[model samples]
Target: MRCQPPLKSMVYNWLNNNHACLLCDEPAEQPYPLCVACEAELPWLDDGCQTCALPLPMQGLTCAECRRRPPAFYRVEAPWHYGFPLDALISRFKYNSQWPLGNLLAQLLGRWLNHRYNEDLPRPTLLLPVPLSRRRLRQRGYNQAAMLARWLSGHTGIACNEQVLTRLLDTAAQQGLSARERQRNLHQAFSVTTSAPIEGRHVALIDDVLTTGATAQALASLLLKAGARRVDIYCLARTAKPGSA
Candidate 1:
């Protein structure tokens, strides 16, 4: 038999390859940014609507809203609930140009998606970032969703196309709007670019967060209208309905 390396030498090599946790600055227990403890403590969405990924108390059941009116996207996959440090980190990444935070979040989500694909989740033919209107893009100096999509693409070898969908209207922010108001606000808000090749293809829409999902519905409808065979939503986090657990 060939001579084997010493156990001490193997341990030293393993330690050198470990990543540092972004949150605590300690040696990460996994390949992603956070240590095992930090990751375990994250506000993960353990149970939710199968179609929209809306957070719910019970698993294996659809939410009443989805049962009544389903979203345009056929399915949603998100890793976390919009709460705690995640919300704060996303705010900083979107508003303050803090790209490292966005990178950390993208890595976490990408790892989750990789595992999901292994479990037979359908991988889209194309990945598209939800478009930011010209006005908002100018004001913010960047589109957070695009950044996240690019980062995820790099991680998972998925090709991301940012120019396929265009935000036609610079609708007011959706933060203060109720569900109905949000849907109304996004009416006719998105249009497909003439050059986009959408026919008979499955597409995934990437975004930082999925709130009421009105925006997602509007865009997914446009993609389907443009002849996409199926559409899926991929976001870093999903918010619970008001007063929901």
Candidate 2:
């Protein structure tokens, strides 16, 4: 396919996802959309715990939470933290009704996944996003995590299990919950809706962010119960602070 003209980038973006932010309705840009400043100020989640991907200190190795109880999703890969540009960007994408950003973020995540997992990382037979409750889906009009999984499937050769896992619980938001609290809040929140036999197969759980890994951990348990041999999380952003998780 030929490249689109620079002037039509915004228009193309709009056409791709109703021409709005994935989380918000603010005007977006071409391809990735969102304003330039928002792109620049994106809270890139750098230097986090390799396993949990929670922002870590330069000296100490692991956070108290990870040390006490490690996350269940094997390892995490996030491009940004859940703050600043990413927070605002995700705000527009999630709350503001900007849906295209979901695809954009997915592409970013796919790029990273390809680089990290293609060579040595265990490849997943399927990509399943942590599902959003119907209420949240109705309120938000879309599931951002699902969109990320779709994008990953499109780019990588991994199969997309759109309905493999379902969010059975409509628990409270995890914004301020402690790691333990978050785990408790999400405990038994998810169940497998479609039991695709994954006996000895690897699976990747896609999500927009990995706050405390509780959600991912909970989902992993369910997927494992369903015979998924391994579970890895593919998240767009991770918190850049230990306490944040």
Candidate 3:
């Protein structure tokens, strides 16, 4: 026989069944917090580079950067272009500890990923979050990437292991850094745990956003060196090239 949810959980769901939209004050649509109108207005990513998911002028074309120096990861998948209210929402969730917003975004991303999986995107065997250093984790009280991985795991039924990757050095922040600078900042910063057997296993790295692909490249290189079969990045948004509208 199937088991029922706890009374507290049921009651909580009941109370939140008709909550207001997070983007606007209108009644939220069922299964997501945003109303239909607001959802339609989001900064959806239409076409991007074949490898890094950077916004591109045409579909099925690789961005110059990728062609010049391909990223370490196989491919990147993101639903939105980092812009406007989406940026604000991600910032609040990541820096301010607003978990509900993060949960809503993760649910939507999971739905998008499911559709992609049906369309022939290879499903990964494990979901791994980019690890945070101990100091940063303590200051933030949580690792947003880890939270995203866990939520994606719950939504997609994929196993998530937060301990597989770790941050060995508390490097300088990557924000505002050029791609080269960002790559340098991440050097020798991450490692895969020895106990986690990633050999021949396809894995997806979860994060809130993908910018410059520097962090993803570093992590993917580490995973590849550690014997992972393949590495793909899954993030909520991907930033376009600087100075592009």
**TM-score winner among the candidates?**
3
Global lDDT of each candidate: 0.87, 0.72, 0.89
Q: In candidate 3, which residue ranges exceed 4 Å CA deviation?
A: 1-15
Candidate 3 RMSD to the real structure: 4.6
lDDT of 3 by residue, 1-245 (tens): 74845533553474477778888889876666788889889999999998999998889999888899887799999999999889999999899767778888888999999999999999998999999999999899789999889889988999999989999999999898998999899999998886356889999999999988889999999999999989999999999999997
**lDDT of candidate 3?**
0.89
- The residue-by-residue lDDT of candidate 1 on 197-238, one tens digit each, is 778999999999999899899999989989999999999999
Say which candidate scores most in lDDT.
3
* Per-candidate clash tally: 0, 19, 0
The positional error of residue 49 in candidate 2, measured at the CA in angstroms, is 1.1
List model 2 lDDT by residue over 90-137, tens digit each: 677778756555556766677667887667877888888788888999
Shift of residue 136 alpha carbon in model 2, Å: 1.7
Off by over 4 Å in 1: 1-20, 29-32
